[model samples]
Target: MDQAVLPLSPTEQETSLGSIVPPHTADAYWLTPYGAPGAWSTNTTYIVGHSWEGRASPFNNISSLSQPGDVLTVTTAEGPVHYKIDRVTTEYKDTLKDSAIWDKAPGRLVLITCFMEDLGGKNIIIQASPLPAA
Candidate 1:
């Protein structure tokens, strides 16, 4: 049977993994699908993303989050959050402000990382939406 072709939108994106800990607290990092493991917290710099081009640039766009086939977990002050891979892409340092990528969806988690230095300092973005309650 032929599959239905659906137009790709920024909402249908993938998720990325990230380690978030309470600021100015102790060595504590939030894990995915699970709470803080015993003493697993450290000044790990909350591994967000690396230099996409090994150059000085602001890594703060959610457009790349619209890529498909990516996964990520979000740990917020509320509790452990999970997201599935939907989309992935790389964008220039200038056009990062395009809110359409993020605003497309609500209560979604986005991961922005730096891709290898080359494609005009592009950023590796992973966008994911919240999973259903257990």
Candidate 2:
């Protein structure tokens, strides 16, 4: 797809992982399907994208180069919200739920993407807490 990831709300009954978490296109980033944005609450905001091999994807940096202290800003209709990285790790794709990154606790940003060129082989997770007052 040529379109980029856009931030939009999902349907109330949107529980299918396919529908809730659309396949990442070359141009777009997908926000979490359930949680409200960090601006709305201390709640977590999840985002997933693909690390398109040899291509420019929105999350390529996060997948390949991000560190524990790096900063990321996500701009929503509410405005720009800042997040300070707290953790970065790699996990096998199938066991993502077993990781602490799935916590429903407040005040978190989870950036998930394919590890290297393998979409299902591995995943790199970046967890961050919302910076004080974006």
Candidate 3:
């Protein structure tokens, strides 16, 4: 006989914004760690920042998403991994260095989404240090 698969509990279902992706999106193309499942499916990401009023919106604007402290786990082209969170602020959308968040840094993880509000709006950014080796 085949066993049944139960759904994840509410607490288990909760995940960070960086890990959550739009529904129906293909996971293979996502900028997440290889070998590991997608962040949204695994719920490995955690929420570090929140709106000033502490309100949580599932689909918040980019500005509202970048509160500070958000985190993300990512896979590098070299196959290494890293994490990052907001450490500094620059011009909203016009900034060029924003992409630097993904570059190899001392940290092992970096979180990026959107920020501010503009034609394309700003992106939420995060930079996280890697966890110690097991």
Top model number, TM-score:
2
Which runs of model 3 end up more than 4 angstroms from their true locations? Answer: 1-29, 32-91, 97-99, 116-119
Q: How many backbone clashes are present in model 2?
A: 5
The regions of model 1 sitting more than 4 angstroms off are 1-48, 52-70, 102-104
Per-residue lDDT value at 40 in model 1: 29
Give the alpha carbon lDDT tens digit for every residue of 10-126 in model 2: 555543332344455754545545465565565577776677777887667565577777888766677777888888888886666566665676867777777776766888888
Number of clashing pairs, model 1? 22
> How many clashes does each candidate structure show, in the order listed?
22, 5, 21
Q: Using lDDT, rank the candidates from best to worst.
A: 2, 1, 3
Per residue, candidate 3 scores C-alpha lDDT tens digits across 1-134 of 01111122222232222233323211112233311322222333322222122343322343444445654344444443434345534334445343554344433333334343432544454444544333
Residue 122 accuracy (lDDT) in model 2:
82
* 2 versus 3: better TM-score goes to: 2
Which lDDT tens digits does candidate 1 get at residues 43-99?
111223333333443343334324464444544456555556566666655555553
In Å, residue 63's CA in model 1 sits off its true spot by: 13
